[model samples]
Target: MTEIETRVLRPDAAGIAEAARLLGAGALVSFPTETVYGLGGDARDSVAVARIFDAKGRPHFNPLIVHVPDLDAARRFADISGPVEALAKHFWPGPLTLVAPLAEGHGLSPLVTAGLDTVALRVPAHPAAQDVLRVFDGPVAAPSANPSGRISPTTAAHVLAGLAGKVDAVLDAGPCPVGLESTIVGGTPLALLRPGGLAQEDIERVVGPLKTAGDTITAPGQLASHYAPNAAIRLNANAAHPGEVLLGFGPMQSDLNLSVTGDLIEAAAHLFDHLHTLDAMDRPIAVAPIPNCGLGRAINDRLRRAAAPRT
Candidate 1:
């Protein structure tokens, strides 16, 4: 494992140049995307893409999502048809990932797609990420910057905690704004591959209703025992359980309630960070069930996946 060095990028020439150089050299760099801190590398380089998998111990079968500068860049990676174009036009530069069939002549390495016929791509809305992308001439393939099946990183420190000695550099762009993964929609009739910062209703509003895939997954962010903390997260409600570290929504911190006052968005932002904290304490954890709507749906999905049986 290589020690990962993180630099707070100055808003000047030197910082951007350094970042571009590291990325161009096939080194892994963690950067802020609107959705979360993504462990990024040149999308066209299979060696760099494979390093992302090796560093995180990610399974080869779970595909990575490519982060592009804009819709035009995305077109170079995947074949965007009418509906896909429409959705990108309206909701892109935000937290939406479209899984379109990879163009036969696409330039992105097959490893980024996990040898699949399709690829997941997004153009983030974060200004910091946009600046970084603009400085670089190519798209980047990045997954959540954490170890495979563990909690994803929303802050640069979180990336350091998990991958400090495993990667080359981390561009400290600060905390992620949306603080979750992008919603992945794929295939005919357009199914939800992963619930994320973007809500289902919002996607449906622009692209029509989406067919939802099952909880089990074969790609990034889809594992049953994923997004887990070292501490056991038991899914309970406001109801208390003995010897359990409980997470409550706004004001509900009976024993670390995650915003016990019931602000779903707050809970969403704090979810992984809190889990990592508690897991560090090595205590047993229980999470109160939240309403399965809007961000709640993404929240609950993460909790369910976290509690999935770990072999």
Candidate 2:
């Protein structure tokens, strides 16, 4: 594919209009969501959707999450009922993606679902994302803006650095607040397809226990060795070994700290940013142990996957 110059669109009326126009014309745009930056394309356009996979080097088997303006918009494509309905009522317009059966005559490109019977839909809470979706006025199939199986981008700079010429443009609205990806839940009796910005315990209180997703790649973000850095990673470390940089969780001195107070919310927001910072330093990563409770589960999940053996 020939490289095209990527435009950095400001967060303004002009930017939103341009973004919507570009998507309507079947072009890929990278914009910020609360969880992370999302590489977006008009979901109904097969060519645009396929370009997303090509740009990110994403496997066709792994699905993409369709971002909509609101829950009502999402209902146009997916049968959000039962557990999906219950979860959507509580978590709509937040960091949650619900997998549900496709609604009849849903116009999404088959590539968005990777040929699955269900589709992953999210009503992102980011104001910029909301504005783009509202003005664009259609479902957008988006995944993390960074290259596939690499660190997810949390800022406009990260997006530019990783995907500069591949996309049509980036809607720059500054850094993402909820730095982790949205928590994904679906399936019979409700299941946690992927742990994320929302805590598991918080969801359990509303929907009782959730079944854990198995090794089967039923959802996006389920790849075994993903969100990886170029350097090797060692988890559960108290300090860095020689030639390694330490990523600290709680109050401790190191190359960088996720949270000085050990707050999971703060840590979750810092996870990707810190990894990006440290990864650029050209050394291995030694991560300080993160508690496996609450949002830490999502942090650890990313770390484990980042540290996983590459294929």
Candidate 3:
């Protein structure tokens, strides 16, 4: 990829127009999704999709989630099973990616699927994202808009700070409400490939029990040591260890609190933003224990990966 000036486009008509134009030309554009900002490329363009991997330094074998405008659009790429369709019907236009066998003549670059027989598809609900996808009128292969295995970007500044010059532009639309990635569910008899912004309980209510994925990297966010910061991480801490910056939950004195009221949703929203802040301080991070319930499960999932030994 050539070193280009990464523009920060506003989330307006002109901005959305530019984003679509760039994407159509097979250029990488970082745009807002409800979960986190995504580095988007034309899913059908092999060169563009390859640039995404180069920009993020992401592994070639780890597939990306193809974001589309609607279920009809998603169906054009991947087969939708009864359970997958149920989840999509319940969670589409929101933070959920359904992985299924690739449809015949899907027309996607093989890079999007990492040479697998399946593909991951998502329909985001963010208005700005909808505008871009609708205007672009095509599937976008997007992964979280930060360097691979690093903290996901919740704001445009984070994107610029991490991916500036590597990508073409960022459609800045402020912070993401859901600060985690979408839950990836797929395989025969639907399995939860990754825990993310959407809660497991909610998905179960919609599609019954979901089988858990094994060690294999079947989808995005399944990487063993992803969503991490450069600094060392310590999870489930009651208090900050000496020389460690504490990321607090439920308001005890600390460097920063995910939510003083102990609300998991609030904590989930603030997770990456807070981690970005502390990681900038050049110190280790100690995170307070978040309950294994609802969004906390996603929060803890990310924290555990952050604390995992770096390969």
Candidate 4:
């Protein structure tokens, strides 16, 4: 494919407006969310949506998450139920994505849901995301702004590095605060599809004991081998293998530390950025054991997937 020069736009009012205009015109724009940057296109425009898949070389079966400005806008696309409503009331404008039944005639591109009856939706808390979504005033189908099954981008430079020539523009709003994807919750019994920025305990607190989703590819980030880097990953390692980089937690003398103080929140915020750093080293990576609690569960989940053998 011929490379197209990608523009990195400022987060000012004019930049947001230009990004919105590009989305309306069926162009791909990468913008920051509280979690990760998303490569977005108008959800209603199949041509634009196809560009997202083509740009990332994403699989057709993996669904895209539609980001709306607020709950009212979200309601227009998905049939939000009481449980979904309760979760949305508390977690919307934060880091939780609710996958629900798609409303009839919702006008979303069929490609967004991969012909499934459901659609993934979220109201991102990022101010730039809010401004762009509000100005665009439509559903924007976006996946993480990187090549398929690779490390998610937490900064505008990461987006440009992976997709600079493929996307029309990237909204440069600096590094993402939450360095993980949103926790995806959905299904009739309200299962946790993907653990991410929001802790599983917090979601269970909102909606009782949540069931774990089965091994089905119903949502984004559900693939067996995903969120991987170029180098092979070894998990729960006490020390790096020969020539391997050690990504340590709670610091016991490693090349890099997620958090020396064992703060899971800080670790979650730095997870992807650190992975990006380690991947650039062009060496195998080893990670210390992360406790399976709170945000640590989400971190471990991502690490395990990253370590999974590639197909």
Candidate 2 lDDT tens digits, 154-244: 9999999999989999999999999999999988868999999888998899889999898887789999999999999999998789999
lDDT tens string, model 1, 18-99? 7778889998888888778889899999999999999989988888988888999888878998788888999889998888
Model 3 misplaced stretches (Cα beyond 4 Å): none
Candidate 4 versus truth, CA RMSD in Å, comes to 0.7
Off by over 4 Å in 1: 1-13, 214-219
Backbone clashes (count) for model 4? 0
- Evaluated against the true structure, the overall lDDT of model 4 is 0.94
Better of 1 and 4 by TM-score: 4
TM-scores for candidates 1 onward, in order:
0.94, 0.99, 0.99, 0.99
| Model 2 vs. true fold: TM | 0.99
Model 3, 109-156: lDDT tens digits are 999999999999999999999999999999999999999999999999
Measured on C-alpha atoms, candidate 3 has an lDDT of 0.93
lDDT of 4 at 6: 98
Q: Which candidate would rank higher by lDDT, 1 or 3?
A: 3
Cα lDDT computed for each candidate against the true fold: 0.82, 0.94, 0.93, 0.94
TM-score for candidate 3: 0.99
